[model samples]
Target chain A: MGATIGRSIQCGGHRTLWASQGRSRETRQRAEAEGFEEVTALVDLCAQSDVIVSVCPPHAAAQLAEQVAGTGYGGVYVDANAIPPALAGRIGELIVGAGGGYVDGSIIGPPARASGSTRVYLSGTGAASVAELFDAGAADAVVLDGFFTSASALKMVYAAYTKGSAALLLSVLGGARSLRVDEALRLEWAMSIPELPARSDRLLEYSGRKAWRFEGEMRFISETFESAGLPGGFHSAAAEIYRRLGGQADESFPVAHEQTLTDLLAGAEPAPFDPTR
Target chain B: MGATIGRSIQCGGHRTLWASQGRSRETRQRAEAEGFEEVTALVDLCAQSDVIVSVCPPHAAAQLAEQVAGTGYGGVYVDANAIPPALAGRIGELIVGAGGGYVDGSIIGPPARASGSTRVYLSGTGAASVAELFDAGAADAVVLDGFFTSASALKMVYAAYTKGSAALLLSVLGGARSLRVDEALRLEWAMSIPELPARSDRLLEYSGRKAWRFEGEMRFISETFESAGLPGGFHSAAAEIYRRLGGQADESFPVAHEQTLTDLLAGAEPAPFDPTR
Candidate 1:
């Protein structure tokens, strides 16, 4: 996703640079194929770039922001990862405190391969400047009129439904399979909601490969919901669902649907009920 | 809904009877309008009917079955409500132990006002007979080839996503509203998922009026998930969401969208997180 974002930036007539000291060989190859200039050190990359976009997994967003801030390189820093608003605000503060412009940003779709397929939402003081970098690219840059964390807030709420509902469906399917009523459930779904069986099929096809990354994102969304004074248990459950499928992240082959159901049910015993929490 | 189901059964050329001793005047009026014959006592109703269909709230299902069982009803008992399979099985046992044939049943979709709008799924030894009662009627009856609780299990899993996702979207909308990013989130949704804004609107319109009943249903779904060794927190959270809106059940008119949002956010403080549960 980061390499594709860099490719979009380069498509907008901007020079994109990456510090690939610890990245995987596949990532290096992808970035190199996208014609990104590679820098050997983080400080060197931070010092040379006018605008830096961070697009990584949710767990790595803050640490990468802190590492970039520690270099004391003043530039527009875009943290475009799925994270809670409070964390996004703190990252913005960390960057701004270190003499750099911070733009709270979030990417909302697949990698920007074509127009209308992806959106880059930006807020904060440096939003317009960062938006300009994607003006001529496939990624649509949307500058929201609100506080800096609005971008991250939107991202959290958006994915809270899409990905959260997918996790709910997977759990439902797993439960039905466990109870030996899966076929009946599918028949009922076909009779009532005709779209769901296909949606569940797509989840089995795609979710396992992305579950590792989504687990962290679900946790972040849980925290986001908690911060907004709603129940966080929905995404917390979603995180558990993704965690069960996390092992399939490195299978190198498509997991069979039945195997995925088995993996989901392997250790998913419910916690004991407590009247007092 | 009970009255509508009675009307559908009557449409199939069967005489529908209800014991209205303690039922409210509104229910009595609805039952009378549906041309259902009213019996003055529970024991009298039990002796006269060949098949007793219990269509009530999830929480009331067991007690209703028990009440009818205490009358020594020997007819086929069909429990058509949203409840966990275990509870349905227990109810079936209670009925069967009382010399009654048990047919585990569940009703999906709205009340049986039209042919295609509702389904009555049945299982167990008496399923065929119960399905025959709804034939040539507005309610389409489907009998599954499995255990008695298969119908209830199908209902549990089906609703685990439909109503559960509605609760999730309500929470997401409430969170966005609380954080003041609702409009921006809607715009992002319009760009990515175009169907969501209208779906969220429909939730605000329809959910509050039915939330009082859905609360127990969500808890039943949570237990259903837990019994299957899956995480129950999704429906637990959904139960909380429904609990907050349960007050709307008695409202004389439709709730405004903004008012519903305010009601949802009211007293929704996050519980303190416990690392160990």
Candidate 2:
């Protein structure tokens, strides 16, 4: 932890390092390799840096916020994860209770040498600077106006749109293939869609592999949608598709850039959910 | 109906006229102009022609065979439509009931300039002459193997696979667009299918217009799946998407082919459910 702090100061590297999941092995290794300091808890991280980010699993988001509630922390704690907004609100409440800043930060894109097809939606008190944070190269984030949970809520909605839809396509197409009507169905799809095949190849491949994440995400949607008094069946069905895809959750997400996806979908492997096979 | 049948011979000009969907006005006029006496209905068409064929709307294929029950019409009744064998059995039952021969025929490939995308799958009963029928160039129909309506069933099954999957993709993509996460969602999709955009474009331009038919077809699927006593929600949902696209259904079903499908789909349009904006 001290070593990472020293590195941050010495090289003006990552100004703040708050690992909400309690310094995962990967985090520890990367922190050590990058010569940055790692704080043990949110209180410690909040005390040390202006930015206290939570980049943990979705389920743990709210719990992490409460961990630092006793401290009179006033710095920004960004919930930078894939959680829905309802969960984000609990975190928001915890941080506000502690006099700390809570920013609903939902990362849709990835940060790497090869940029991923991801985005970050942030709301809550510290949102304005949250968007500026990416500009200063501190992190990749976006802060939009809404409640703390709104961004995450919006994120869940978006994920439902993408992941859930993918599962739907896969199921019907698979049925079609089993019936040996794939070509005619493809034509019918083509006839019906006019140009959807162009966009479909990539999405299908991604959905086939990411069924697990979608499965988990779908649960969140089911809760959110049902709580909002709407039918939760949409998300429930999505959960089925992803959970059944087996280990694709362990597989890396699809590449975001056009060239990479083009190479993949055009190759012999065929797109994931495309039932044209 | 008799007049149309009589005209097919004139339109066809010395060639065997399998008034599959009856005759187009031009075909009818020409057939009559060609001076061959026309016959009415499948029974007469079979008894009089060197070979008999039975073609109907892809959806009513099973029912089309039901039209020929107990006729004792000896010539082969080529079942060329989209359907499944389980349903095809009904057709075979009807043919054998009448002591008439039946052949399973699935048509594949897009029709040549003189044809449509009418490849055939032949199964059961009279496979040889069925093959000969296509060789005889009955509206450019091709033949596959097996019995009765298997070919048509294969067609429907194939349609289910391709179209259903594509429809599924479009629905999800549309949701992504609605969420304003199209970029990120698309990136995710592309990683799985590079050919997605082109496919999507094609769907919008072509299939979106024809998607209306899918709603009715989905009803069939819903029943098919439900008959197995499982949830038929997928088909029902698919039907919803097609219906939601609405207003694209034109009253433009080609006159000659309209009768065959009008009763099946309830309303045959050139393009009934266009989804693209």
Best by lDDT: 1
Worst 10 residues of 1 chain B by lDDT: B268-277
How much does candidate 2 score in TM-score? 0.63
Query: How far does residue B40 in candidate 1 sit from its true spot (Å)?
Result: 1.9
Runs in model 1 deviating more than 4 A are A252-254, A269-277, B252-254, B270-277
lDDT tens per residue, model 2, A1-277: 2232223223433464644354568667766676455567655676777776666555565666776666777877777666655566666777778787777766554442222333456676668775665543323345654345556656665565556556555544444444444454555446445564655556555654545455677777656544433334556655655555545545566634332222222212321221221
Tell me how far the alpha carbon of residue A184 in candidate 1 is from the true structure, in angstroms, after superposition: 1.4
Q: Which candidate is the best by DockQ?
A: 1
TM-score of the second chain, each candidate in turn, equals 0.94, 0.64
Pairs that collide in candidate 1 are none
